[model samples]
Target: MNKFGVLSFLMALISVIVFLILRGPNVNLLLMAIILGSLSLLGIIFAVISKRWLSGIIGVLCNSVVLVSAYFTLLAYGIAG
Candidate 1:
């Protein structure tokens, strides 16, 4: 198992929870979520290439959820296109 991949996946999950909980006019949080989601995508790619299926799958799911939620949240706030 790739520890870095696992850690990245966990961080992605935490970011999602934070994003959902802190739903307000916080542009910083939205930016942070976007950064974390991108990093998580990299983590997923690396994990899969390294044969760390569990970490890769988790990262993919968490990152997808966070990115989608972040997009809608930003749209709702009129902060994104």
Candidate 2:
């Protein structure tokens, strides 16, 4: 995985943990899931950009992240469009 991506993952994890701690267990789980899901998107992006084993792993991670992030975005956006 790229250095920046790893850092981003770690940061996301830390932020989620902190948010959960402060926002209550229920909210934390929901938020963490969303964040991880979003970070996983990096994995897919990495896969397309890189051919290394690490890149493949990151791509998977990024895909998950993207899914969750997209979910949340849709949830927030609703069907307003």
Candidate 3:
């Protein structure tokens, strides 16, 4: 794999480890935010490194997921009320 792939793999691994370490009611949400944030950042990096536009499109999709998840979480906690 290339450098970007390696970095993405590392980012994914970090997210998993963080989730495992923070798997509790009081902190799972926070952990999720950190994971999604990292994923979004990595996606952007991947988008920047690719020669094709598809990679950038995927990055935008990943970012949207992160954003939607954040909004969903906020709504779950009645933060939007």
Leading candidate by lDDT = 1
TM-scores, each model vs. reference: 0.57, 0.35, 0.50
Q: Candidate 1 lDDT (Cα, whole model)?
A: 0.63
Clashing pairs in 1: none
lDDT of 2: 0.52
TM-score of 3: 0.50
Candidate 2 C-alpha error for residue 72, in Å: 15
Give the alpha carbon lDDT tens digit for every residue of 1-81 in model 3.
456644544554554465477656675565466566667577557655754565455545555565566556545556523
Segments of candidate 2 deviating more than 4 angstroms = 1-27, 57-81
lDDT of each: 0.63, 0.52, 0.57
Q: Give lDDT: candidate 2, residue 21.
A: 57
Local error of candidate 1 at 20, Å? 4.8
Which lDDT tens digits does candidate 2 get at residues 43-66? Answer: 455455555566456545646555
For candidate 2, the TM-score is 0.35
